[model samples]
Each structure stands twice: as structure tokens, then as C-alpha cells.
Target: MGIIRTTVFTGLLTTSTAAAYLAARNPVISPLAATDPIWTSSVFKRHNPSRNPATQDVCIRRIPLDKIRPELLQREGDLALEFCRGVWSGWGFAVQRKYLDLKYRGPETAKQLWTNEELAQSTYDRGTCIADHFEVVEKTPTAITVRCGDSPRKQDPRPSDGLFVISATVDKQREEVELRLKTCLFSSEGTIQGIKGPMPAWMEEMHQWYARIWSETGSWRLLK
Candidate 1:
């Protein structure tokens, strides 16, 4: 309850503090339920810069679960349904609000995870290095469970503790992949480092670049 409490509202609950708080409160509620939120936000540092190097924006996304997927069945597709009901609905709005101050292609990275298999596999690999072991626990018609390989070490209190369940739903009717990613936002104290700051002029230039991309592309469209 408290876990879901923080992600939905932007207060003092940072990623660095969330994991431990959730772990302490874990026995009562399922991690999947904890992921649900109407609103979610995050701040991330952009990696490489075309122009302005130092950019930080808090992005937010708000979406209704019903409008999100037309084909998600309620009874059979529980994991996928729960995740969409919880996270994905919020993720789009988070992106819209610029909560995750990402480097280049942050939104692209998220889109790729859902639509690209090779990229998803690479993500799985990266999680392995961060944790001791990772495994896909269950695979449903449209959902799967991924358990972390290693538990957060008691002494290593950086804010990572819990399992994740992701789902892949194929709209057989539409021939589209409806991939859903659901995970606990832990307090990793994890910060993206080594970004070379650009001049103020460069920031303006990069903004134009992103604006142009958003204006032109269907996925990154900027509404007038």
C-alpha cells in the first residue's frame, strides 16, 4: 500500500528510499499490486548530447487502462491486465510530463523494450549483472513472471528488493505486440554519471532537435 503510495505521487519518496521501504512492507501485499499508480514521475540524466549536455526534466504520463488496450481480456490475462491496470497506464503520462530526465532516446529505449525482442533480451542481461540471478518464472498466454536472481544484500542497503512480472500480449486480431513491463521502483541510489555538460547554446540546439523529432515522427509527435 505504501509502496504504491509513493510512485503515484511526487513527494519525498525517491527511488533510493523506495526499495527498502517496500521490502519492509512486502509480506502483506504482492509486488504486482504495489506497482499500480495513476501518476508516476522520475528524473534521469541524459547520456549523450547532440548539443546541450546537462538536461534534467521530470516526465509524467497519465492514461486510463480501458483506453490503453482494446483487446486485453479481464479474466484470462490477469498479469498483463494487472500490469496495464497498474504501470503502463501511468508510464505514457510519465513520458508526457517529462518526468524521467533521460539522455538521448529515453522514450525510444522504452518503446524498443516493448516492441523489440533483441533489446528486451539485452535488458534481461543487464538486470542479471545488477542482481545475482534472474529468471522468467511463468509464461502465460499473454504474461510472464521474472524473478530476480539475487536478493538485496542486507548490508548493501541501496534500495533494490522485489520481483517483476512482464507480459507480452499479441493482438491476434490486430497483429500487434502489446508488451507490458512491470517492475518495482527501488531506491538504488543509482545515478547516471559521466555526462559532459554542454553550453547553454547547446541546450537550446538540442531542444530544437527533440522538438523537430517530436513534430515529425508519429511516435514522438508533438501536438499543436
Candidate 2:
């Protein structure tokens, strides 16, 4: 059988790209800062050797972090905040907190061990919790690291290392942010052979563009 023709959908995910400064941080004050044009414009294909019909399909969405509603941001931060708040509450301290810190001793996933239902609910209710600036920069995605701003120096227990770093700017606070975004749609599932491969012309053109862009746009940032 030829590569199964999967019904895929693509759309604009979120905000656009832009630069801004902290409105509150005046001239005399120091300013803290940080911060895809794909699909529809381009086509990506799976390159595998299996000839069987593919099993799974994927949808690609570019979630512009900048445009996400404040309510949405708050909701996303809930679980993270609760994890941190829980740590403080257990010690009988109930002051306002802005960040969450989590760790696991043995070999296990960080999210699985850190998550708790009550903590999640508490974090959402507070809505006051916001991740620090440093958090965003460290979390942005990179092709090399997958997770943006992730320092290669640190080690992770997650066996498969395939996460994308997504970051966005919000408000005038110059709060840099990073998120490891994932979707079931990005994966190439089912019969490997049935998966269509990149067109020869597109592959050749992409390599040429990559080289040109890297040379012109990525002087200090070497892309491989």
C-alpha cells in the first residue's frame, strides 16, 4: 500500500513576534528582558522506510504566546504555582509567592511526581502566582535543546529527549518566558513505509535556505 493520506489540519496558533521594554522600569531603572512561520507557508513530511499505511495523524498549530489571554496564562501557571505554594504551606507559611520549584530524587518523571489535584486547584484559584523572569528565558525552545532556554549542563530523567521550546512576551513587564509545548499531532505514527517522505525539490530548497539564513541571520548562533 502507498503512504496513507492522512487528513491533517494547520492553523495560526497564537501571537506574533515583537520586541518591547518594561514600562515600569524607567530610564533611570534597569530593564530586564527576554523572549514559527511554518505550515500553510511550507510543507513538512515524514521520512521513514516502512511501506505500510500510516496509523496516526498530526495537526500543527503555532500558538503565539504573546496573544494568549491573561486568563489562559494564569490557568497554565496554576499547577506550577501550587507545587511551590504547597512547599511553603506545609511549613505553616502562607505568604504570597510567585514561583514553583520541583524536584525528584529517584529516576522518574518530574511532572508525574510533582503534580497533585489539590495543589493544581489551589494554584488556579490564587491566580496571583506568576513565574519569575528567569524562568521564561531558561524555558524557550531551541532545535538543539528542544526545550527553549534549557541549559545542556543540566540533566533530565525523561528518557526520550524530544520537546520543543516555545516562548512569548506578555505586557510591558518584559517578562521573558519559556514553555515545553507538545501535541499529539507532531508525531509520525503507524506504518513507517506508508508515511510520505519530503519531496526532493523541497528538501533541496530547504537545505539551501537553511544555509543562507544561517549565514545571514545566525552569525553567532551556529545551527546544524
Candidate 3:
């Protein structure tokens, strides 16, 4: 078949031109941040012996949190959550979520357009992913660890993804906040394309494409 569509984060797989398409028009923020996005993965040989190295996906976007539009959040909302939400709220991922919501029988009740408070509550309260399609594994002022298996689709997938952590760390020295999106896939019985081991290079490239979108979306929201 064609490229195997995968990852709640890999929405760009179907639409490869999304970045180029969106790039034509100017967004609110430019240059993203002082640093470029970083993508890395490891199997955690000691801790996660059964984990697949191909399963872990980490996307990092470093931007100045101080430069955010104050009007976007005034109440007791976490900026970091908003940053991560923006990554999910990006066009490609949003479309995939909505499509799944329409196709699935048990569509989640979470709002597609989230408010700052809603995100904060979802994370800090450790609410079920259905409340919002995110499961809070851990939370701090600067970082929040979320799992992909929050909803039915993810909980039951072709090959499931694992823990996703988003961090918006403030640094006085660097004068920018680092927004990192990390996901380590948990082992399951399923495998894509009869390959029980690592995925194809195209799949890896697709992962990198979407990872960059995480920062692009975050940057757009930072200015919007």
C-alpha cells in the first residue's frame, strides 16, 4: 500500500505539502525562536528493555515564553499547556482528530477549540483523555508529561504510541523558553507493514516533518 499513516502526531503523513502550503502565507510569528527544533529518540535499554527504539518520538521547540501575547492568557492558565495545545491545534493534527471523531462510534466530548483554563484543568487534575484527548502523566509549572493512549483510538491502535511530554521551560540566561514535545512508544502486539522491527526511512521522515510543525504551530500561537 501507500505510506502507512501513523502517529497521533504524524498528521502530516497524508498531507506532505501542508508545511509548504502554510508557508506561503505569513504567520504571526517569524523565525520560531533563537534555536532550531531538535528531534531525537532512544530505547532506554536499561529502563525500557522491551521498548522499541523506533517507537519513541521527541519534538522540541525553543521559543521565548516571555514574548507571548498577554491577552491570550490572563486567568490562572498555564502557558506551557497552551504552547503544547498549539502544537496539537496545528492544522494537520486538528484535521486528523476531527476526522477520527466523526468516524469513531465513541467520539470524545472534549472541545476541539480549547480554552487555557480547560487545558490546565485537564493536565493538573489528571482527568481522563476523553475530557480532552490528553492524559497527564505528570505536571509542573514548566513541564507536563502526557501519554498518547488517552482516547479510545490511541488506547486501541494499529501500533500504539506512548508517553508524550511537553515542556516550556523559562531560562533567564538564554532568555527563551524551551517547548519540548517528547513521546516514547510503549510495546504492543501490533506492527505496521509486516515489519516487526524499525520502520522505513519514509516513515522516519514523516515523523520529522510533523515534529517541525509542532514548533511552527507553537510559534504562530505565541504571536497570535
Off by over 4 Å in 2: 1-113, 117-137, 140-159, 169-224
> How do the residues 77-141 of candidate 2 rate in per-residue lDDT, one tens digit apiece?
43223223332232211122212332222233222222233333332221122211011112211
**Leading candidate by lDDT:** 3
User: Each candidate's TM vs. the true structure?
Assistant: 0.24, 0.19, 0.58
Superposed Cα deviation of residue 17, candidate 1 (Å): 33
RMSD of 3: 9.7
Candidate 2, residue 198: how far the Cα is off, in Å: 14
Q: Which regions in candidate 1 have their CA more than 4 angstroms from the true location?
A: 1-131, 152-159, 186-224
Cα error, candidate 1, residue 75 (Å): 20
lDDT of 3 by residue, 1-224 (tens): 01221242256435777666433321222212324221222312322334444344555555564666676445434667666666555543555556655654243454432443443334443433533455555566665666553352344432444556666655658876556665555444343343233545576556655656655555455553
User: In candidate 1, how many Å is residue 110 off?
Assistant: 32
Candidate rank order under TM-score:
3, 1, 2
The candidate 2 region of ten consecutive residues with least summed lDDT is 1-10
Error of 2 at 147 (Å): 5.0
